[model samples]
Target: MSATEIPEPQVWLDERGRPCPLPVIAMAKAAKSAHGSPVIAVLADDPGARYDIPAWCRMIGATYLGEISVPDDKGGSAYVVQISESAQTDASKSIG
Candidate 1:
């Protein structure tokens, strides 16, 4: 990782058995905790989470930093997503 890039923390939610919305919700909470300056790597096996995570980032004014698919032994895809800072007033004014 570069000095300008803060490596995100990866969380593997074993809720692959629970189904849709729960994984999305968990990812949202995780992202919220990593709200500023760093990203959160949300690895979810739920298919819905692939879309829901990015959508949540959009709704919350955070940057959807893209994702990578991870091979899982449990027979599902793992999504690596990065959530950037929220676009608050002070955040918007920063000329970087």
Candidate 2:
């Protein structure tokens, strides 16, 4: 989704500077407390995140809505995921 189209009070994660897998881990962690199919925005400069987030969604059954633009100061692109409302009642409780 576009910047204006992003969900209100969305979970915005700053996973920049983290190593491989950390960004995905952080995204999954935030999703664990989520309700509805809220969109999550992860600001990550790690190149792996571009590939990892979508892979995580495929494995976790969430929707990978692709990346969106952020302000120059954000220092990273925002990758969004739509937590499937039916995926879990307590969000993603497992790491697998």
Candidate 3:
């Protein structure tokens, strides 16, 4: 598959319409869609994500690979975050 078609989960936050938690929620949905263990990337326009994404990663026990800033032609920025496998699953869960 092509790089764009790699099947990685991607969440797009509404840049002009939503607020802080919405971006975080979007990231969560993308992570959840990974079926408990896959690296998902989230694209958000909210400044909150710079901190929120990493914080969420911590709460979910996922690895926050970090964020990249992509500038749009129109003069805005898009933040892409790489969520690691550890962040996707509840590794703390124990076998019964």
Candidate 1: regions farther than 4 A off: 1-11, 87-96
1 versus 2: better lDDT goes to = 2
**Can you write out model 3's per-residue Cα lDDT over 9-86, one digit (the tens) per residue?**
354444434668877777676665565345555555567767887787778777665544443444234444455666
Pairs of residues clashing in candidate 3: 62-87
Per-residue accuracy of model 1 over 17-88 as CA lDDT, tens digit each: 657787666666665555444555555567777788777666666655655444356655554455555543
Q: State the lDDT at 23 in candidate 3.
A: 71
Give the root-mean-square deviation of each candidate in angstroms.
7.3, 2.8, 6.4
Clashes of 1: 0
lDDT of 2 by residue, 1-94 (tens): 5656655437788888887688888887788777767778888988888898998888878888877776458587788888886555434556
Lowest lDDT block of 10, candidate 2: 87-96
The ten-residue window of minimal lDDT in model 1 covers: 87-96
Question: Between candidates 2 and 3, which one is better according to TM-score?
Answer: 2
Candidate 2: stretches off by over 4 Å: 1-9, 89-96
Arranged by TM-score with the best first, the candidates are: 2, 1, 3
Candidate 2 has what TM-score? Answer: 0.79
Candidate 2, position 12, lDDT: 83
